[model samples]
Target: MTDFTLLTVVVLTAIALVTAALLIARLAAPRTFNPQKGEPYECGVPTRGEAWFQFHAGYYLYAILFLIFDIETVFLFPWAAVVGRIGMQGLLSIVFFIVVLILGLAYAWRKGALEWK
Candidate 1:
């Protein structure tokens, strides 16, 4: 009836559905364990080097920058879908959002986050 009640119902329903699905899967799915499944492998060849080798921090910085821009795409899509209905206000808001993202990207670029080396 009320907004809070509707939200509570939706949350409870989602929890219940997820619980049921997981329980059903646990009960119905086949369980098989093999020794080969536990080993580290790649391209059907056994790995020779240490599995826990440290990577350069620059790689992580590049990934984080990519993820930030990727999320910008996610936000832009829904806004674009309702752009006509939202008019000038939404356009200005999204423009601001895009400007901020562009600034962030520029900062990353200037700092060489995009560079492989």
Candidate 2:
């Protein structure tokens, strides 16, 4: 009914759900014993070479592109759906939004964030 009551209910529900899930997992899990399980491995085989390796910048490029275009598409769809009613002001706003996004891409390019390797 009230904000505090709603918050309390949400928190309690989350706690109960998490507790239930953990309890179920603990009860249902296999108890097999293996000395090899204690050792660190890649696909159950011991790791070779360095334990850590540097990730490629391509991951960041993909993520940034996905974020930018994904958001652009999301915003553009709704605007397109109502294009006739919003007039020139809406058009200008979207143009401004696009310009800002281009600026972000330009900044990323200048910083060499798009480079692969």
Candidate 3:
């Protein structure tokens, strides 16, 4: 099968499996209807303010910056394992990758994305 076909099949199968599982669970689970069940936060403590609230943009910026570096760190693990086998080329490639990430981080820093407002 083609790569696209394989991917489509895999995705469809996952969806079907998940749907079937959820259906079965819903059917088999005990049914106890309670007013508090409808509330998302039913931890016995009543909510005081609005359910939805706005977060400062700084938090999102910090999370995005963290994920960028976190994914870069993940890429380093595989390269580290094969470091000896692929000598200078691998080393240079990883160095280049790191340079690109550093440049991106510098750009974000300069853009005030890292500011803890």
lDDT of 2 by residue, 66-90 (tens): 7876888988999999988999999
Better of 1 and 2 by lDDT: 1
Residue 17, candidate 2: how far off, in angstroms? 2.5
Backbone clash pairs in model 3 (N, Cα, C under 3 Å; residues 3+ apart or in different chains), count? 0
**Global lDDT for candidate 1?**
0.89
User: Which candidate leads the pack in TM-score?
Assistant: 3
Q: Candidate 3, which segments miss by more than 4 Å at Cα?
A: 63-104, 107-117
- Listed in order, each prediction's TM-score against the native is 0.54, 0.49, 0.56
Model 2 alpha-carbon miss at residue 76, Å: 8.0
Tens digits of per-residue lDDT, candidate 1, 1-117, equal: 999999999999999999999999999999899987777878777767787889899888878878888998799999999999999999999999999998998998898777788
**Model 1 TM-score (2 dp):** 0.54
Report the C-alpha displacement of residue 38, candidate 1, in angstroms: 12
- lDDT, residue 10, model 2: 100
Q: Which regions of candidate 2 are displaced past 4 Å?
A: 2-15, 28-32, 40-44, 49-51, 66-86, 99-117
For model 2, what is the error of residue 70's alpha carbon versus the real structure, in angstroms, after optimal superposition?
Answer: 6.7
The lDDT per prediction is 0.89, 0.87, 0.90
Error of 3 at 89 (Å): 14
Deviation from native of the Cα of residue 15 in model 1, angstroms = 23
